[model samples]
Target chain A: MGSVVMHNVVSVDGFIADADDEVGPLFEWYGNGDVEIGAGCTVSKTSAAYVQPMWADLGVLVIGRHLFDLTNGWEGSPPAGEHVVVVSHRPRPEGWHPEASYFFVDDVARAVAKAGELAGDRTVGVAAGDVGGQALALGLVDEVAMDVVPVVFGSGKRYFGPVDSQHLLEDPHVVVQGDRVLHLRYKVRR
Target chain B: MGSVVMHNVVSVDGFIADADDEVGPLFEWYGNGDVEIGAGCTVSKTSAAYVQPMWADLGVLVIGRHLFDLTNGWEGSPPAGEHVVVVSHRPRPEGWHPEASYFFVDDVARAVAKAGELAGDRTVGVAAGDVGGQALALGLVDEVAMDVVPVVFGSGKRYFGPVDSQHLLEDPHVVVQGDRVLHLRYKVRR
Candidate 1:
């Protein structure tokens, strides 16, 4: 099975977004550099090298329902991956993006399992939030990736989301400094 | 005047300590390696190289009263620095560590001013928390240094304290991967 990596761009204080779901300056790096990867996104060469391969290898993305509603499933075209698995209690909206390969699962574990099946040997990217936190707590995530921005959001939506217990991760094996972001990847300790 | 750097070891979730003021695993890296920096503290060679110079250049430390009370000002022997400035409304305890260069000040800005005066050309380290937040907000901080540990503390005392506004920092000029810790330093954008 492919590895499941939980990922997000977060503030220095660990907030993924503000209370109103605004990203503020968290996404600044995507446009701050001269290197263009794809989908109107340009980043530093250092970031492109670290992020492009990860996006290319993504076979599926698992996200929470909140994200699906927020981005409308990214208008049926995610940043990467051919398939998306959204964890939500509600079923997919009727007649919504019929051609899109989006799956809605009620449970986080089941969602990740379905993502794994869809990913095959490729990587499964899990959006970091409530669902990602649950997947991590269930020991379904293999790696944790963060694109740390330089701004601090004093209070807002946390990146870990609802996880109440401590989780230990191995030292980051990948550390790449970009224009306005630092990319770090740590393996979840078994 | 020397640079005023706010410093602390924080969890990936951006917490300096738990609600009870326990650091838990955040300080584990200080003793988890072979290279002994000083005062019986050992750390990875990578960490020592990055941290020793910072410690050696510290001529003064400014800390909030809560931290001073928590550790009793590290028993009058701080980890670094020749003088310790405690930010508190109350004066120092009568005859408490009189021989130690510990000063009690009633204001954050005043404490930092006194610290700078005492530090001269050496760096003045400020413990991250409420006082640190105020200092940063008041534009008294020159840099932010964090030793990020690989654990998630769901919710606890924040490293930035009650800072409610956004602050921009330059991309970290220093990023050192250490045992169980990632040493990062970013200059405060003026």
Candidate 2:
């Protein structure tokens, strides 16, 4: 069996961006500098310490059209390590990453299934917070890790909603730094 | 100047609910009880434990149509202790609440401003998850607390969205838990 993992930065007030659709400020908060805190551990070394390694492990990447546009140039695109799937009605643009094999799917489920199928024995990383929540709601995500930022977007879009009522979380693990940021993890239960 | 607070429950995966609008199911995860545990400092026997006398100071309640219906008090209306503001496009029903004042405003801003005015020296409570999140995004809520349920609602409406990213938490001043519910308190920065 294969699984998808989603990681995101959410505002303290439960928003991802402001009303202006800008998440740059939130990104800037984590982009200060990378520092190696201890053995195999680092704090704020490049946006997030966990993202780079997590992204590296993924054999497949599933992203939404909006997220695709946000990264511009397929973002860390896994450097020839991961195949990418994009869900969009829009046509692919010219001069896209050739190393990255891109497929346009019409729905979230198809996009997810394709990622799982392509992932083979490896893990599939679902990137967008919104879509990631949707995948979790659909019982597709196997695990989730969130590096929750302490800033409130003040107005934009929220990551999740008041959805179904029967879903459950197995164990909640977290590393808290007294309000600076929290890296939380949860296992999805069916 | 006014500040808003967020009280909520998120899955270890950081989901407020599943894909369905099922808050009731989320509550069952706390081990079958309604109140999870005691949190923060309690002001009264009738109030949530996390809520202090400061929250009770807010004398008004603001909510959306969905919540008003969900609570199912179309006939008796809100109690006399607090003035209730319902944000909806429909016309206000004649003599909606026998013991309290009911103002139905289409615009969110108006509803908020009027609530502030009516609340006078007291605080204003933005009711329901959806409307509560909206008010927080608009920078309307001053102090808030939520009964965080454990269920992972499968598929319906979500309480917050990436769209709700307008604001983030300033500091998590408190965390309280009951057997089936949790109470989280977050401050909104101006």
- Fnat, model by model in order, equals 0.84, 0.61
Residues B129-174, candidate 2, lDDT per residue (tens digit)? Answer: 5676667667666665555444444344544432344444555565
Give the poorly placed runs of model 1, Cα more than 4 Å off. none
Query: Candidate 1 — number of clashing residue pairs?
Result: 0
Compared with the true structure, what per-residue lDDT tens digits does model 2 show for residues A1-190?
4667765666544456655557754554453455643323344643346455565567887777887787663543543235877877776667676555777686778888988888897788776456776777777778766656656554456554323335565544433443346555566656
Q: What DockQ does every candidate get?
A: 0.85, 0.31
| Candidate 1 TM-score to native | 0.97
Interface RMSD of 2: 5.1
Best by DockQ: 1
Q: Can you give the TM-score per candidate against the true fold?
A: 0.97, 0.59
Native-to-model Cα distance after best TM-score fit, residue A127 in candidate 1, in Å? 0.6
